[model samples]
Target: MFCVSENLYLRDVKLSDSSIVAKWKNDPLIRELSIGLDTKITNENQESDIKKSIESKQPYYIISLKDSDRPIGYIRLNWMDNSERFGWLRFGLGEERGKGYSKEALSSFLQKVFSNDTHRIDAEVYAFNKISLNLLKSLGFIHEGTRRNAYYTKGSFFDVYTLGLLKGEFNYIKRDDK
Candidate 1:
């Protein structure tokens, strides 16, 4: 599957993209904001994951510029609860940070997700990560609540903000309906 939004696009991740993904997964800034802050990732680990996830046809994608074959980030639709028509959302970008790439990629990805079996999508963000919080909020994700002291990192605990967005709540399509 693929999603194109303006100059950005999301495509199924290839095994060749594992190295860059592993690098981002191990970045200090990325790790501190992520749930698995304590765990470390290596290329070998990423390679193994790539192989298994490919076989399982996991819903993960590489984010790239529309005309480029190189990926600058990744996103995944995970833990699909068919009974609930919900999926857990996860995304990350590398050196491509500070750009609007993520915003565009996410907007497109969510549109694609909701067009199918997904009714709602959920995201967990570290309270300290203002960038992610703002991005989700700007995209219409509601603040469900916070898991107090849910994340432990840098020798301290931090709250985790839980955010959710229903398919009906997303305005990606209507924004251009006019």
Candidate 2:
């Protein structure tokens, strides 16, 4: 079950979500930056992926516009190594890029995640993906560093830059958000 606020919503992904998910995944602009865009999704593929998330209790949810109920994206916190005290945040908003929604969607998503007592949140982005980097940085995520040639994409290996936001940072932003 997803707990959504009045302005943003997160819902348990349904099988019915496949068509849109497929469309989003296949979009060239989105695929060039996504983590799983290279893979083709069949019915079994979707079920298996969702099952894996469920089994590990990954916090996966579809994000949607509040007023129109139009699904826009999905965000998740995963690979939570107990000793690390943080989880990786990954999201792809598909063709819905540049509408000023990522910030709001992300702010709400972080609000939900940090509410659970996590120490920090981190994201590793391909250095070339300026859009994603900007979104994270605008939300106060700091540039930790980059791993040269870390990701294989678009017929080339890409450097991945890591960014992070501390719990206190999130709190400070929220407190000042008003």
lDDT of each: 0.83, 0.75
Give candidate 2's error at residue 171 in angstroms: 7.3
Query: Candidate 2, which ten residues in sequence have the lowest lDDT sum?
Result: 169-178
> Each prediction's Cα RMSD?
2.7, 3.1
lDDT of 1 by residue, 21-140 (tens): 999998888887774678888888888887886887668899987777668889987656645378888899888888688888898888887888778899999999998998888888
Over 1-178, each residue of candidate 2 has an lDDT whose tens digit, in order, gives 3656545688877657766776776677777776545866566666667777878777778888788888998887885686546899987786667766667767877876767778889998888889889778878899999899888865888889999998768632342342
Error of 1 at 119 (Å): 0.1
* Residue-level lDDT for 61 in candidate 1: 91
If scored against the real structure, what TM-score would every candidate get?
Answer: 0.89, 0.83
Residue 139, candidate 1: Cα error in Å is 0.9
Quick one: best lDDT, which candidate?
1
Candidate 1 TM-score over all chains jointly: 0.89
Best by TM-score: 1
